[model samples]
Target: MTKTGTRNRINAGAWLISPPAFFAVALLAVPLAAVVLISFWTQTGIRDFDTALTTANYREALSDPLYLQLMMRSVWVSAAVTLVTVVLAFPIAYYVSFHVSPRRKPLWIFLITIPFWTSYLIRVFLWKVILGYSGVLNTGLQWLGIIDDPLTVILYNVNAVVITLAHAYAPFAILPIFVALEKIDRPLLEAARDLGEGVVQTFRRVTLPLAMPGVIAASLIVFIPTVGDYITPRLVGGPGGLMIANMIQTQFLRLNNAPMGAALAVQAMGIVAVLALVFVLVLRKLTRRLAQ
Candidate 1:
């Protein structure tokens, strides 16, 4: 094509995307910028903020013992949730991709998404009920004569938080892995088999490598949001299960310190960003090694 034609095509493509691009900038970038900007400000009084730039909020957010503990706890819980969700999701996704009939694949996917039919709060609340002292699990265990007392250990704790978040994010992890698995060439498995590789070896060498992209995507999707999750931890987490997001919420609402909250939020985001980048890089390197 001529240079003018190429330019026109580029201009047309730009025009087509301009509206959504502007929308993204307005809704996403603008709010993010505002948060980062507010993180540097100081709170002077109740419902009062000083526009002067300072790092006191960041300093306290990073240095304070409580905040540091909360940050560490959030990371730990998020990691556990990511690990559980992906491990559980992969088998389901793999089964659907490799075992289920193509015609029934859509139905399986639909079933996987059935959790989305309910409100997220409702789901968390339901888990709270199931894990409660006298809840379904304890009652069932008691009826079966397995336990004498309703277990108090499962509800309103870090274990409860991990369980709830893992279940909540399971579908997010499944679909990406399903898509990635679907894209794998069946002949590669056959070729591996023909080359004297066992089923497990074929999978370890061929299937998992190609599916790493989706696994990586699912991990990030689950990890990023779970790290910042407030509702699940608030409803089911109790005191011990509360995460950095809970602290941030307290700063913003209960303590009336938006600047501190914003600083904490920024730091949480930075930690998640670093972890995600490292995860992707490490996974990619491992994937390459597995492929070879």
Candidate 2:
């Protein structure tokens, strides 16, 4: 093609993407830029902000022990939720993708996503009822003579937050894994078996490596949003389960310190970005080593 024709094609492609590009900038980029900009400003009074740029918010957000504790709690809670969701999801995804009949796979996937049909708040409340001292789980276990007293550890704490978040995000974790497992060529598994590998060995050498991409994807999907999750932590998390997001909420609303909240939010985003990057890099490296 002539340079003019190539240029026309490129221009046409740009024109086609311009609408979505504009929306992305308007909806995502602009808001994010506004938050970052606000993070550098000073809160002088309730409903009052100094437009002059300052770093005090960032310094306090990072250095304050309470803020640091909440930040770390958010990180670990998110990590725990990610681990549980992915681990449980992998088996379900594997079973549906590898063992279930292809004709029935869609039905199984649909069933797995039934949890999403309900409102998220409703689901969290349902979990609260199930995990409460006098809740279904405790009552059932008591009836079965498994425990004489109600369990207090499972509700209104970090455990509750993890359980609720894990359950909420389970479908997100499962779909990616199921897709990855589906894409695995059955012939490859057969090849591994023919080479005298056992079930565990074949999976370790072949299936797990191929499925790492999905696992990584699922981890990121669960980890990123859960860190910023405020609702679940609020409803079921109690005082102990309150995360950095709760503090951020307080800063923005109750405390009337939007700048500090923005700084905290930016810091949280930075931490999540760094951790996610490290996670992907490490997982990819492990996958390469496993493949080799």
Model 2 agreement with the true structure over 103-192: per-residue lDDT tens digits:
999899889989989999999999999999999999999999999999999999999999999999999999999999999999999999
lDDT tens digits, residue span 63-138, model 1 = 8999999999999999999999999999999999999999999999999999999999999999999998889999
Whole-structure CA lDDT of model 2: 0.96
TM-scores, in order shown? 0.98, 0.98
Query: Where does candidate 2 stray beyond 4 Å?
Result: none
* C-alpha lDDT (0 to 100) for residue 275 of candidate 2: 99
> Where is the poorest 10-residue window by lDDT in model 2?
42-51
lDDT of model 2 at residue 80?
99
Task: Provide the lowest-lDDT 10-residue window in model 1.
Answer: 55-64
Residue pairs in candidate 1 whose N, alpha carbon or C atoms collide under 3 angstroms: none
